[model samples]
Target chain A: MTVEAFLPRDTTALALDADEVAAALLDAGVQLTRNGSRGAFWLEPLLEVKVNGERIAFGPVTVEDIPGLLDSLAAEPADHPRYLGPVEAIPWLAGQQRLTFQRAGLGDPLCLDTYRSLGGFAGLEQALAMSSRQIVQEVKGSGLRGRGGAAFPAGIKWQTVLDTEADQKYVVCNADEGDSGTFADRLLMEADPYQLIEGMAIAGLAVGATRGYVYLRSEYPLAAEVLVAAIERAREAAYLGQDILGSGRAFDITLRIGAGAYICGEETSLLDSLEGKRGMVRVKPPLPAVEGLFGKPTLVHNVLTLAAASTVLAEGAAGYQELGTGRSRGTLTLQLAGNIRHGGLVEVPFGVTLRQLLEDFGGGSLSGRPIRAVQVGGPLGAYLPESQWDMPMDYEAFAEIGAMLGHGGVVVFDDSVDMAQQARFAMEFCALESCGKCTPCRIGSTRGVEVIDRIVNGERRDENLILLEDLCVTMEQGSLCAMGGLTPNPVRSALAYFGEDFG
Target chain B: MSAQPSSKSVIAIIERWKDEPGGLLPLFHDVQAALGYVPPESLSEIAGALNLSRAEVHGVLSFYHDFRTAPAGRHTVQICQAEACQAVGARALAQRATELLGTEFGSTSDDGGVTLEPVYCLGNCACGPSVRVDNRVHGRVDSERLEALLAACRQREEP
Candidate 1:
């Protein structure tokens, strides 16, 4: 009898001693294989026994528990207390409608054969058969929008790039996954790098661009290493560079490491940084699709957007189009994080209520306290009170409520959290990360912080509150990019939802 | 101006990337990777090679936080103090860390054992308070874990 155990080599999983567990499993004469996460974070150090091509899960496992688990699995795979039966059948996972993330948490991330076996590269293969126009049309048919918080239509961006004529064009993947509580980009890059590579290659094919780049942040050193290695492997396998799969087209990817700056995640700033300049935001009359990246037309997309493009091509527009609600198509890879019990990557289709994700998927707070607030998106996102938990995780739905589904990162906070402090932090973070491209953001953020500080210190709270609101409006209207523009989201939302905390 | 280790190596680094468009960042990265930090002496060399002014080179170098102006300590410890990490008591952890090291954020220890820096987020938000010791990242780092890590760095310090 052959038994195999798979563990996620992702950043979070490694931090939880998955590496130590892997070593321990090896010492016990158990043949182990490392794979991507199954999104079951609570069960991390999660081991899966593949019996007859079906995976049985065991987890939150320590080195001490390994011997007992191996013994029980040897006797009866289903008899172990730690075993959660069929891996896919788990209610938490089975309920999720994974489209873009279908290949995530599977076999070896780097293996070309493992990828092909699990429906990887099918998108590129399918895309290679179609003309650029047909590919763009198919994407348009899918109704997919940017998963990178902007909610811009992916097909429209592609169409514009395709329409534009330039001697040199580029497809740049925004792998600077800097949003707080978000790890989907990091997870995809580490677990399923080929998907991102294929997506970019497909975009290259569609846009008549031969060169590509993945501008990853320096904070994620592991992701950078994994992506760089994967790009090399892809190049060797003829999946990238010169002529791809005998398709008579040429495209290649380069990995550029970002110096620590949150502003660089902005498309124009990213392009500026890519040109080896200071990562400052640029005024945008010439959209990136028209003029970008060394003054050549460029298509800059977040990692998930490109990954989704790969899936849409592979599964056909209709297959992806069938999953999501309203304007939102396909699954949103929601990153469950912070002060949560079952926090991990949960990729579900749009329209799922926060109540469902928080109660059913996240399993409430990690501290076992009542979840008082949730911050959707990043630092720039709103601090939603429990009353808004029933709100759907849709782009338009979130916007309607004066909130956002920015990058689909849901950070839970328990009742013990101070809303005033969180609000102050919003201003402080803006003051720290603002690129100083515009005055409203540069000066207003510092002033906003002081105003909030005055309110916190109980110095004419009513007057200061009004002043802070007015300041937020000025910054929101005047800032060049989302960095300063959205800083007021958390501050204003906190004021609206948790006003008592201010007093 | 004082002399550099060898002008040939700096020229070689410049020559390698001079043909590639927008190659200054990678050039600086290579220089920093080979040497501990971007030495001030190489600024003129880089400026001449890239055909830019000294102020331009200085602007790029100072704009980024990664390119240290001087040599870093043996170990670089970056603790995440962003919102997600802060939710789980990273501020307290950061304060305790500074107290243990007898230095504040962005400062090297008195013994030059460790340089503690505060990063916004390490992208391990799920399991943070996250800390990066050199290139390796660790999550759920409490005061005890931090003390153990700092002690290890102290032990490895050159006598």
Candidate 2:
């Protein structure tokens, strides 16, 4: 009998030597098929064996454990210490809504047959039946917004691109997920590349765009390879290129790799990088929706946003709109990471609180120390203290508390963490990554770092603290893009919550 | 110290991508893949072939941290020093790695065995402090794991 097992090809799984484990399993004469992770990261190198149509999971497995695991595979009861029973029944994964990431940790990442069997291309098949206007209406009615931290309504951007009378329209997916502690974009791209391709293709159909681009970060080499291979397969299968899916529409995507600039995560800077120029922020008024990518009407959406597009269309507006709460309809792929015991990807409805993510999903601090602070969003995101742990994960709720749910990456910090150093690192990060397009981001970031250093050392404590606050405000209000604008978020939050550290 | 990708190969790479609009980035990736780094000599050739100036090519290469103008050592060891990695004691690991290697970040060892560099993050935040040996990333690398990895790098370097 053939035994099917799921093993993640993700960076985390790779770090745990999942490849070596696979090799060991093969050498031991065990037949296994590799599948994407189940998002139970604490248990990664999480291997699952198929039995009776359900997958029994085992993990945090090493090459050392493979022989024993294989021996028990043919045992009467199929009992193993690492066995976690059915994958979906695992409490950590059972609770996730997983709309955008529906196929995230399941099928063979590189196999088209696996993707098809798991309901991958069904959305695009459904989308091919709808008119562009109807597609826009469905998306708008679904209340889908940009998942790349900006939180702008996706339908509005698509509509603008649709309305614009450009001879050439483009759909761009911002896969430059530079935010620390976020792997959802990488996970999706590597695990389910077709989901993104399907969404981008649908976006093209909706916006009259024949060409699409995915600006993938260079950090994710594995994801780039899988996506490129997947796109090639997609074109061969007629899901991309001329006459997609027998429809007369032509839409194709090219993968553009980003160099090591964090500023490129900003949409305009990403465009500049795509043009093979310096990744500097561009002045707005004519947003990318009006004039973008060689000054054409471009629809720019985050990897998660575009990946979720097909699902929105597949289930119709009402099915998607029915999930989540208030204005934040639909699920958010919350990346629980950093110094947390059970860190991994957790996609749930928008109303889940930060406390639940830390306690329930993350299972508190990894170091056994008390959890002190958590940075929501990316590097530029605010560092919330324990006092604000009850804050809901919704966009508006976070905004009300002077925080923005920028790309749903929650980086936890144990009591051992020094907030002063974190704040300095934030400034340092901005200084290193600032594109030098604007004065505040370029100069203010370095200046912010110097002032913070002074505060950390024994300088004029009260005055430098005031100066740091003022510098943060200037960067926040004066900078042209989020690179400089949001650099102050972490700095200010560090001061507000952990003021004693700064002094 | 060794042979680089021939000029013929570089030209072929340029010809393959030159016709596309804004194709320099992808072309650069191919060139880097063939030759470990984008040699200065090839930059002028690429610029001339692609209808771009030398400054434009240079600007593009210098802007991204991934593009290395100089050739790297036999092995490249990149340690994650970002906030997430730092929270999990990457700073100490980085210091120990540098101390053991007898070289600092962005510098190669005396024997030219390995090049150590500091990367922001490697997307293994949950399991970091992470380090990358060549292209493969290893997470949850404590001092012992780092020492072992460095030893492996040295062992690989020896004949």
Top TM-score prediction, candidate number:
2
Where does model 1 exceed 4 Å of error? A76-81, B1-11
The interface root-mean-square deviation of each model, in the order shown, is 1.1, 1.0
Candidate 1 lDDT, A1-503, residue by residue in tens: 55577877878788778888898888877677788776677677778877777888887777777888888876886677778888888888898888767887887788889999998899999899999999999889999898788989999999999999999999999988888898889988888999999999999999999999999999988888889889999999999999999888999999999988888999999999999888889888799999999998899899999988888998899988898788888888898888888888898888999999999998888888888999999889999988898877899889998899999888888888999999988888888878888998889999998998899899998899889999999989989999989998999999999988986
What lDDT would candidate 2 get against the real structure?
0.88
Note the chain A TM-score of all models in turn. Answer: 0.98, 0.98
Judge candidate 1 against the unseen true structure and give its global Cα lDDT, from 0 to 1. Answer: 0.87
Off by over 4 Å in 2: A76-79, B1-6
DockQ versus reference, model 1: 0.72
Q: TM-score for the first chain of model 1? A: 0.98
**Which candidate ranks first by DockQ, i.e. highest?**
2
CAPRI quality level assigned to candidate 1 from its DockQ score: medium
The true-versus-predicted C-alpha distance at residue B87 of model 1, in Å, is 1.3
Model 2 per-residue lDDT tens digits across residues A207-310:
99999999999888888888889999999999999999888889999989887888889999999888888887899979999999999999999999998998
